[model samples]
Target chain A: MPMLRIEGLDHRWTGARQDTIRVGALALGAGENLFLHGPSGCGKSTLISAIAGVIDVAEGAVCVAGRDIGSLGSGARDRFRADHIGLVFQMFNLVPWLTGIENVILPCTFSRRRRRRAGNPEAVARRLLGDLGLDPDELGRKTAGDLSVGQQQRVAVARALIGTPDLILADEPTSALDADAKTAFLDVLMRDCKAANTALLFVSHDRGLEGHFDRSVDFRDLDRGGTR
Target chain B: MIGFSLRSLWNRRFVAGLTVFAIALSAALIVGVEKLRDGARDSFVNSASGIDLVVAPRGNPVQILMAAVFGIGGTGTAMSWESFEWLENMPGVAWAVPIQMGDNHRGYPVIGTDVTYFEHVRHSGGQPLQLASGTLFIEGQADGAVLGAEVAARFGHAPGTVIVNAHGSGDVSFHMHDDAPFTVTGVLAPSGTAIDRMVIVSLAGFDAIHAPHGTPDADPLDAAGLAVPPRNTRADHETHEEHREHTGHDHDEGSRAAAGTGEHAHPRGRDPDGHAHAPERLNAVYVGLADRTGVLGLQRAVNDRAAEPLSAVLPAVALTELWGITGTAERALQIMAWTVALASIIGMVVMLSATLESRRREFAILRSVGASPAHVVRLILTEAAVLTGAGLFLGIGIFILAARVAGPVLASRFGVQLDTRGFDARELAVLASLFGAGLAAALVPAIKVYRATLADGLSVRI
Candidate 1:
C-alpha cells in the first residue's frame, strides 16, 4: 500500500456556495517524491487545506499510513496528521518567538507518538538541522524571526522532517529563496527526506522545482471537472 | 505551556506592563481603604469606649469629637467656669476632666487638664495612662509638663527639658509663648491612643500663656466680668509683659515660673491669694456618669440648661455618627476603585481582543502543525490566565509596598495603627472574586479564537 492514497475526494466551503476543491484520485508510494504544480487560482490552496484536515472532506477517502483519514473525527484526523504527515508551509512558518530548535520541537509537543519516535527529540532535531546545513550553535542561538529567509526555510524544513513522518508535504517552502539558494536548499531537503524514507509532496506554481523531484504533475489534472 | 506563554508576553512587555499597572492601582486603592478604615474605626472605638459623655458648647458633634477627642481640626469654644464647677459637683457625676486646647508644642497639640485627667482618662483596650519615666507635674511646679509617648520619642523631649508653645493648634504657628516654656516632667507610656500624639500640661499652664498681662484674665472671651485689680497694684504677679518679647524659639527663664500662677495652680500649696485667681472658663469636659442608666437624664439636663446653651454627646453615639459620615466618603472611594478594577478587566479583554486580528496567523500556523482548534483555544486562554494572574500578583505587590512606606507615618502622626500582614477573610474573598472576573473576561477572546474559521489562515494563495 502507498504511504498516501486519495480517491474521489470532494470538499465544498458551505458559505462560499461553490466547490473549492475536488479530486478524483491520486497516490504516492513510500519514499516517492511527487512535484505538484499549478498557477494561482487553481484550487491548490483548497487541496492543501483538505490534506491537512483543516476543512471538511465532503466525499472521498484520504488514506495516510493505510488508515482512511476521512473516517476519523475532527480531533482524530488532527491527531492522525500530527502523527504521520509533516507539513512544510509556503512562507517559512516558524513561530517567531521560538528559537530554531524550539520550532522544530513544536510538532512533538502536540503528538506523543512523535515524541516517542524521535528518541530524545532535541538530539534528533539537532542532527536533522545539522544535515540541513544549519549549524548546531545557530539552531540553539538565533530566533526564527531574526534568521534570514534561506535560514528560516531550512529550519521550517527541519521542523517538518524532525520525527521522520511517512509523508512530507512541502507547500512552496522554497518560494522565498533566490534561484541559487532554492536549488541548494532543495538539494538538502530532498537528500534529508530520501534518507528518512519519507514520500515528498512538493507543491509550487513554479515548475523550476520539478527537476529536484522524482515525478511531477499539474494540480488541474486531478481536479474533478465540475462547478469548481 | 506557561513558559511559552511568558515568552509571548515578554515580546509585548511594555503593553503588558500597562495592563498590570492598571490592575495594580485599583487593587492598591481598595486594599489601602480597607486597611485605613479598619484601623481608624478600631482606634476610635478603643479610645472612645471608656469616656461616657463629652459636654461642650453646642456645635457639630463630629467637629466637637474631632477637635476634643481626636485633637484634630481647631479648638472648640469655652463654657463658663460655673458649668464646670456645677457639673463636677453634680449628684451623678463621678468625676469630670476639663480639657482646653489652643496651644501646640512642636506640632503636637497641648491639652491642659488637671491631674484628674491622668486619673480618669483611659485608652486602647481601656488601659489607663502610666508614666514611662519621671513624675506627673506637681500643681505648684509651674514649669512641669508631661509628654505623650510619641511626642517624647519623636521630639526627643526628656524630663526637665522645656518646650515653647506655639499659639495655635495647627503644626505651624505665628505666635509662640517662648517665655512660658513648660518643663517636661514625665513621658507617658505608649497607650496607642490619641494621647500618644498630645502634650499634657496643667490647666494653669494653659491659662498663663493666654493671660493678658501676667494678671490672670479669668475669661478672656468675656473680659467685662473680670475685675482686673489695677495693673500696678498687682505688679507682684507674673506679668505677660515680660513674656511678650520672648516669641518663636526664644525663652526667658524668669517668666517660666511666673506663667504657672495664672489660674490652674495645682499641687502648688499657694496662699489663698493665688486660689483667688482661678481661670473662669473650660473647653470641653469629659464627664463620667456614676451610673450608666443615669446617662440619658444627665444628657437631657445638660442639653436643657437654662443658664447656658450646652450639649452633651454620648461618645459611642457620636463616634458612630462620625463613621457614618466618613463611611459615605469611603464608600465613594471603594466605588471608584472598583470602577478602575472593572476598567482593568475590560482593558485586559480589549488588549487580548486587539491581538486576535494579528494572532490569527499564529493560530492558523499552529493548526497546520497538527494543533487542534482546541489547542489554539487553550493557548489563548492560557495567555489570559497568565496575564490576569501576573497582574493580580503585581497589584498585591504594590499594596504591600505602600503599606510598608505609609503605615508607620500614619501610626505615628494620626495614632492610627494599621495591620499590614495578611488579608482578612473579606479581603481574600474580594481578591478571589477579582481573579475569577479577570479570567472570565479573558475567555471572551479565548472563545473567539476557538470558534475562528482558520482554514484560509493555513492556505497560501500563491
Candidate 2:
C-alpha cells in the first residue's frame, strides 16, 4: 500500500460560494520523491495545508498509512499529522523564539510515533543538520529568526527529515535560496528523505527543480485546467 | 513552554515595559489611597488620647467634642462655678480643668484653666507635656500666663514678657484690655493639641478681667450712682504714671485703664454704694475622671445635681458620634477612591487588549511550533501577572518612604503618631484583591489570543 492516498478531495472556505479545490485522486508510495509545479493562486499552499490535516476537506477522504483521515476529529487529525507528516513551508516557518535544533526536533514533542522512529530525536536533528552542512554551533546558538535565508531553508529541510515521518511536504522550500544554495539544499533534502523511507511531495513555482524528483505533477492541470 | 514565552516577551520589551508601567502606576495609586485613609484615621484617634469625660451644658455631645477637641466650633455655654466645684469634689474626680474660649490673642485662643492641666494631662504614647521654657504660673497668680510653644516662639517672649490681649476672636476689636496685659511666666511644650497655639491663663484671670465695674451696695433708689467717684480723683489715678511706648501707638495710664475696665465689672462685684463682692455664675466645666471605670457614674452624679442643668460626656464617644453625622462625606470619599481604582483596572484591560492585535503573528508562529491554544493563553496571563506584581512592589516602596518621612511631622503636629510597622491583614487582603483584578484583566486579552491562534492553525495570519 502507498504511504498516502487522496481521492476526490474538494473544499471551499466556509463563507465562500465557490469551490477552491477539486482534485480527483493522487497516490505516493514510500520513498518516492514527487515534484509538484504551479504558479501563484493555483492553491498550491492550500493543498499542502489540507494534506497536513490543518484544514478540513469538504468531500472525500485522505488516507495516511491505510487509515482514512476524514473520519477523525480535529484533535485526532492534528495528532495523526504530527505523528506521520512533517511539513516545510516556503518561508521556512520556524518559531522565532526557538533555537535551530529546538525547531528541528519539534515534531517529536507532539508525536510519540515520530520520536520512537527517530531513535533519538535530538541526535537525529543534529546529524541531519550536520549532513546538510549546517554549523554544529549554529544548531544550539541561533534561533530561527536569527539565521540567514539559506541557513533557514536548510534548517527547515532538516526539521522535515527528523523523526523519520513517513511523508515530507515541502512547499516551495528552496524558492528563497540562490541557485547554488538550492542545488545544495535539494541534494541533502532528497538524500535524507530517501534514507528515511519518507515520500517527498515538493511544491514550487520553479520548473528547474522538476528533474531531481522521481515524479512530477503540474498543479495547473489538476485544477480546472488552470495555468500560470 | 515557559522558556519560549519568556523569550517572546523579551523580544517585545517595549510593549512589555509599557504594560508593566501601567500596572505599577495603578497599583501605586490604589495602595497610596488606602495608606492615606489609615494615616488620617490614626492621626485622629491619637489626638483623642487621655481625655476621659468632658462636661458641657446640655446640648449635642458631638458638637461639644468637635468644638473642644478639634478646635472646630463656637463656644457652648459655661457650667456654673458651683457645679464645677461640685464635680471636682466628687470621689472619682481626678482633675476638672475648664477650657474658656470666645477670646483670642493674635488669633491664638486664650484658655483659662489651673496649672494642674499641664501637670496631669497625658497625650498619645503616654507622653507628658514638657515645658519649652519659663515656668508654669503660681496657683493664685491671676496675672501670670503660660504661652503655647508657637505663641512664645513667634513673639520671641520668655518669662517676665507681657503681651496685650485684643479682647475678641479676630484681630479687629473695638476695645482692648491694655491695662490687664498677660505676663508670660511659662511656655508649654509642643503638644499638637489646641493648646499648641494658645495663651493659657489662670481661671481667676478671666474673672478678674471680666469683673463688672459696679458697687454691690447700690440700691434702686441710688439711681445715678453717687456722682461717679469724682472726675478729678479718676484723673489723678490716670495721671500718676509717665507715658510708656506701646506697640503701634504711644499711650499713657488714662487710656490704658479706660480701655481695660468695662462698666459692668462693678455691678458684677458690688452694689453702687461699694460694699464687698458677689459671685457670678459659669456656664459649663470640663471634668476629668480619675478612674475611667466610673465615668458614667460620675456623669450621672453631675447630672443629678438639682441646683443646675448640665451634661457630662466622654470625649471619645462624643467625637465618634460627631464624626458619624458626617458619614455622607466619608462615603463620598470612599466612592471617589473606588472610582479611581476601577478606572485604573479598565485602563490596564484596554492596554493589554490593544497590544494583542500586534501579537497575533507571534501566537500564530507559536501554534505552528506545536504550542496548543491553551499554551498561548497561559503565556499572556503570565505576562500580565508579572507586570502587576512588579508595579505593586514599586507602589509599596513609595508608601514606606512616605510613612518614614511624614509620620513624625504629623505626630508632633496632631498629638498622634502613626505606627509605621502596623500593616494588618486588611491591608494585605486589599493588595491581594487588586492583584486578582489585574490578573482578570489580563485574561480577557489572553482569550482573544487563543481564539485567533486557533483560527489561523499552523499558518501565519498577519
Candidate 3:
C-alpha cells in the first residue's frame, strides 16, 4: 500500500471570495521522495492542511498507511497523524523552550504507538540528531531557541525522522537556509528518509533543488481548479 | 505535558514570577486575617471563662463586662456596700469578689479587692491566679499591694518596691497619693488577660486614700450590720510616720527591703477576717455560682434588686453579645481579604491571556507535532495549577513565619493569642478553592486557544 493517498479532494473557504481547491489524485509509495513545487499563496498550505487532516475535506478521502483519515473523528485523526506521520515547517519549527532532544522525542510523547516503535526514544532521538550532523551532547544541553537557524532546521528534520513514521511531510523545510546550507540540508534529509524507508513529501516554492528528489510534481497542476 | 507547561512558563519567568508573588500575598492575607479574627474572639471569650457572672451598677451589659473584666471603660455608678454584702451572702453564691476601680499606678488599673480576688478569680482556661514572687497580702494588711506581671515588668517592681497610688486610669495622673503608698507584696505570673496589667490592692487601702481628710476613721461595714470597730486610726498614724520618713525621697523607691524599712512594725499585725475598713461603695463584683443552673435565677434576682439599681450579666452571654456587635466588622474584613484573592486571580487571568497572544506560534508548533487542541488546553490549565499550588505553599510558609514572628508582640501588646498550628481544615479549604478558582479563570485563555485554527499558529505571520 502507498504511505499516503489522496483522491478527488475538494475544499472551499467559507468567505465572500469563496476560494476553492481541487486535487484529482496523489500517492506516495513507501521509502519514496516526492518534491512538490508551487508559488507562494497558491493553495499549497491549504492542501498540506488537508493532507495532514487538520481540516476536514469537503469531498473525497485522505488515506495514510491504508486507513482513511478523513473518515476519522477530529480526535482520532490527531492520533492517526501522531502515530503515522511527521511534519516539519519552514521556520520557527522548534518549540523554543524545549531542548533539542526534547523536540526530537516530542512525537513519542503524544503517540504510544510511535514510542513503542522507537523502542528507546531518547537513544533514537540522539542518533537522529547525530545523523543530521548535530552534536547530540552539545545540542541537548541548550534549549532549541539557543540553536542557530541551520542547527534548528536540522533539529526539525531529526524530529520528523525520529519515530520512522510512514511518511515525512516537509513544508518549505530548507527555505530559511542559504544556498550551500539548503543543498547540505536536502542531502542529509533525503539520505535519512531512505535509511528509514519512510516516504517523503517535500513542499517548497524553490525549484532549484528539484533534481534531488525521486519524483517531482507542481502543486499548481495538482490543484488545477484553485483560484487566487 | 507538565514538563512542557513548566518550561513554557519558565521561558516567561519574569511575568510568571510576578503573578505567583501576587497570588502568594493574597493567600497570606486571607489566612492571616482569619488567624487574627479567631485569636481575638478566643482571647475575648477566654478572659471571662471561670467567672460565671459580672455584677455592676445598672449599665450596658457589654460596657459592664468591658469595665469589670477587661478594665476597658469606666463603671457608670458605684453600687452601695449594702448591695455587695447582700450579694456576697446570697444563696448558691460560690464566691464573690468586689472590684473597685478609679485608681492607677503608671497606667495600670488598680483593682481594690481582698484576698478572695486572688483565690476566686481565674484566667485562660480556668487556671487560677499564681504568684511569681512573694505572697498574697493578708486581709488586714491594708498597705500591701500585688503587681500584675506586666505592671511589675514595666516598672521593675519586685516584692518590696513601694509605689504611690494615683487617682485615675489615665497614662498621666496628677493626684498622687504620696501619703498612701503601698508595698508590693507579690508579683502575679503572666495570665494573658487584663489582669496582667492590673495593680491589685486591699479595699481598705483604696478607702484610706479616697477618704476625706481629717475625719475620724470610719468603718462602713458597721452601717452594713457588721459590728466592727474603727481600725484605720492606727493604720493612718503608721502611714503618716512612713510618709515623713520618705517625704524627701521618691515614693517608688521608698523601701527596697521590707525588713529594712522597719515601718511595717505595727500592733495591728495580720488580721485574717477583718472587714474593718471596707469601703462605702464598690464599682463591680465578679461572682461564681456553686450550681451552674442557678446563674439565670441569680442574674434576674440581682437585676431586680429594688434597694439599688444593679445589673448582673452572664459573662459568656455578654461575650457572645459583644462578638455579635463586632461580627459585621469581622465579616467586612473577611470580605476584603477574599476580594484581594479575587483580584490576584484576575491578575493571573490577565497575565495568561496576554501571553496567549504571543504564544500562538508555540501552540501552532505543538499542533503541527500532532498535539490535540485538548492537549493545549491541558497545558494551560497545568500552568495555572502550578502557579496556584506554588502560591499556596509559599503563602502558608509566609503565614507561619509571620505568626511566629508577631505572636509574642500581639499577645503582650493586644492580649490576642494567635493559633499557630499550621493549615487547619478551614485554611486547606480556602487554598483548595483558590486553586479551583485559578483553573476556572484560566479556562478563559485555554478555550480561546482551543477554538483557534491550526493555520492561525502555523501561518508565517509570527
TM-score of each: 0.81, 0.70, 0.88
**CAPRI band for model 1:** acceptable
Which digits, one per residue and each the tens of the lDDT, describe model 3 over residues B1-462? 888788889998999988998899898888888888888877777678789989999999999998888777678868866688789889999888888887888777898888888888888889999999988887767789998888888779999999998887787888788767899999999887878888898877776555433322343322322222322455434444444433222334424222112222221243223453345568899999899899999999999999999999988888889989989998898899889999999989899899887788888888777888888889989999998888877887888889899987787566777787766787678788988998999999888878773446345354
Worst 10 residues of 2 chain A by lDDT: A219-228
- Which candidate comes out best when scored by TM-score? 3
Alpha-carbon shift of residue A73 in model 3 (angstroms): 2.4
**Candidate ordering by lDDT (highest first):** 3, 1, 2
TM-score order, best first, reads 3, 1, 2
RMSD, every candidate, angstroms:
6.7, 9.0, 6.0
Local distance difference test, each candidate:
0.77, 0.67, 0.81
Residue B227 of candidate 2: its Cα lDDT? Answer: 31
Report the lDDT tens digits of candidate 2 across residue range A134-167: 9857768888889998888888777777788888
Candidates ranked, most accurate by DockQ first: 3, 1, 2
Flag the better candidate by DockQ, 1 or 3: 3
DockQ of 2: 0.26
The residue-level lDDT of candidate 1 at A6 comes to 87
Error of 1 at B362 (Å): 2.3
